[model samples]
Target: MSEQPPSDCFICRKHRGEISIPGGAIYADDLVYVGHAQIREGQTIAYLGYLMVEPKRHVPDLAALTDEEARALMILVTRLSRALKATENAERVYLFVIGENVHHVHIHVVARYAGAPKEYWGARVDEWPAAPRGGTQEMEAICARLRVYLQKESG
Candidate 1:
């Protein structure tokens, strides 16, 4: 993979600019940012708490991650998963290591709602239909909520 600037990669740019979706980012250190993913215009995936834990550096694969990136990833996933279940009211938090469409290393942490289908569990979780998405104001609110929770945990 060619070198991608923080602004060029989907996850990387999110580390620097306006969050494109609701519940976008909760935390960021020198290595990564815990944020949300972008959706196709017509397609929606999982429920809220659909977060993306992304490395601030434009890393292309998991095997390429530094020791710090790997360690932070472990910490973020464990903490963020709990944060989703507790604060976002998710029964389960689904995680996906997405490097297919984009080359960067990003983790998808999706919240499973009250009646999420078993068929859509595991790898197929991304196929679920997410409706009633919030607009910018709502999105910002969600981000703020997660940010607070993450901050508390980090502190």
Candidate 2:
């Protein structure tokens, strides 16, 4: 059998700070980072932090995640999806895990809206236009609202 991957992976490093998302983080737990989607508006990405639900082991694939870990992740994803829809008034939500660069198991919750630009609608994948990055003020507003929503859900 192939040896297990390194315990300290690049994803963990990026989570530490190499890749920072401004106004990006909304919630986090020992096992996940729930934050705004990187490329799309109203999108959210939940990074599965570690393999174990508590012990926080490192693993290369979803099969390494325990059943309970999977279930808890599902619950959190569903809550975030619902919160996004209700808070953002999204038309629909998309969930995916295609880790081409990060090489870690995680989920994306994309809030699809009507009139979303063509660049975001296609499967062929066009380059996202260079729209102005959201400012600190915008991010602060989003973070505040998201925190309220998440706190309410968790209570």
- Angstrom error of the Cα, residue 22, model 2: value is 1.3
Error of 1 at 59 (Å): 1.2
- Top model by TM-score, which number? 1
What's each prediction's TM-score?
0.81, 0.65
> Model 1: per-residue lDDT, tens digit, 31-76?
8787655555775432445777877788788999989889988898
lDDT of 2 by residue, 1-155 (tens): 44335344545544565666545457766666665544345543221110111113355456778877677678777777777676766555667666554445666665555555766753312233332234445555655676688899889
Task: Show where candidate 2 strays beyond 4 Å.
Answer: 1-10, 14-20, 39-57, 117-136
Mind sharing the TM-score for model 2? 0.65
* Cα RMSDs, all models: 2.8, 6.6
Identify the leading candidate in terms of lDDT.
1
